[model samples]
Target: MPNAANESSEGTGFQPGDGVVEEASELQEASSADRTPEEEFLAQMLAASGATNLKEAGLYDPAEVAAEEERIEEEMSPEERQAKAEHDALAAAFSMIRERSNEGKLTTPGTWAAAGIVPDHLIPVDFSDLAFDEIIAAQAASAAAKKVAEEAAQAVVADADADAVSADSSVEDVAASDSKADEAADENAPSVDEGDSLDSEIETPEWKLDDIKVLEGKQTYLYSSDYMTDTYAHWAFLAEEGDDALTLVDNAREESRLYPRPMLAASLSSKPYYWNAEQIEQAWQAVQESGSYPDINTCEASNGERYFYSTDYLSDAQAKALAEWYSVERYMNV
Candidate 1:
């Protein structure tokens, strides 16, 4: 009989009864006995590629393989997971450490001094950094200024009071002297003016009564005064004309004497320009029937102009009547 392994190889196609076939059979047997399938495949690839050793063939070293095995085990283990978690926590704390280190560098002058750092010392300190004596001095200055102002104000008040007292004394002296002069005049007047008696003096003619007129269809009253010494004298004429005239006269009496004369003239002239001839006739009839206008003012014969006088100026009511007439005329013409 043949050799047992050789007989087994001949049963398969590896043996064709030649020397080369016999060598192949021996190699196959050696591989089957010594190597796993994976190793055998690696070795076959390495030989075909003409590499001399495992390292040259790009095959992993024993150390690297062992490390790969440990890595796989660690990935699957809870202890490895805990160790990785601890490493991540350490990395996160690195930023806090860096910030604390920077803060320490800023606060501790000795740290910067060791590194030869120089301070600028340029920032200013406020009142909070002032010495106690300096603070007290500032407060004293403020109090002194306030006291000076108060002293000046008190001096002014004292001077004003002294002037007021002097003025009061002068006024009292003047009033006493005037009283004495009035008494002397009263005692001496009747003996010296026998020929020039008060009644024989040329009586100042009062403003003529029948000369005033209000225009037709108008509510205004007009007057003229040729020789009146003051505008205020005219109000006596209004008082005699009853309520309408008296009401206006009272208001005028209260007005200031400084009001312009032309404004007073315009206020008394309230003839509406746009009234038709019929309306004019009706208004004229009303005024003539009432007989109220002539007692209130005088009119001029030269141009049918009327005038009134008062110490106080004509009031807003009288002014508004004239303005309304002018506005109506203007609008109608437009």
Candidate 2:
């Protein structure tokens, strides 16, 4: 006739006799009946810790959480629960595989073992069988493309050298022609008047320049002899000191053994030489008519803008080869 529940609690590993059973029963009842969200959260955290207090369990022990998960799986429906377990296992295996690959490690069975992700019979077949051939084929194609580009670049260099020689020849021819003309002019000059002194000046030849439209804030100047001679050399010489179009093109021929590409009309309006729209057009027209550099040519891009290149430095075929190589190289780098 002692308290029957107290006797039961005493028979268990708990302390006896002091109304412990009733106190524990009441606490359980209160938790089940009206637990607040904060209390429920603490209960879960404590369960994950597998200890009476958080400090005793060292915060949240992963081993305890894993045990709790196993306990949860035991309560779920067999079919749904087994499927979910397999999915989680596969996800973990794949995550290890991806991490190995990201670390620049080879994807082999050894790598999977190192990551502690052994291949399971229930998972799919070997990944190498699925993807290795395709990857190798792609790499081969890339290598071939790079080889082609390198060959094209070599061809461009050869063409540039040949064009430079041709440009030099053209310059020599111009110099010789000028020398001959000077000799002929001296021979044809009328005899000076007997009354004239030896140091008397000769009258300059009369020449005229055509008027050109210019930007409002700028002025254009032309030498009369430039119009009369209508030569690329004369035009280049007559071009203003700061004028870049003619000088830029000429210097490219002399220094680099390369030609400046055709320029956009709008592109010339700004920068080191601010050529007006009309001026650029006129200058290009004069270049075409000068018949000086036979190798000088123009080509258009897909954007419908024309660019100039000197054949005197590189032939058309050589230029095309170099261009294709560069285009491929750029694409690969990208």
Local distance difference test scores for all models:
0.37, 0.43
Candidate closest to the true structure, highest TM-score: 2
lDDT (tens digit, per residue) of candidate 1 on 280-308? 34444555466654323222222333233
User: How far out, in Å, is residue 260 in model 1?
Assistant: 8.0
Residue pairs of candidate 2 with colliding backbone atoms: 163-312, 261-308, 262-307, 262-308, 295-311
Segments in model 2 whose C-alpha atoms lie over 4 Å from true places:
1-239, 242-245, 251-270, 320-333
lDDT of 2 at 181: 50
TM-scores of the candidates in the order shown: 0.15, 0.23
lDDT string, candidate 2, 1-334, tens digits: 1222232334334222222334323333456447676556655655675655544434443455565455555655655454454445444544443453333222343344455443343333343232223234444555555565566456555554444444434778757655555554444343465214312332211111121111111222222221223233232333434444454356334422623233334555544246686776676676677766565555544444444556667666655554444434456677
Give per-model CA RMSD.
50.4, 38.8
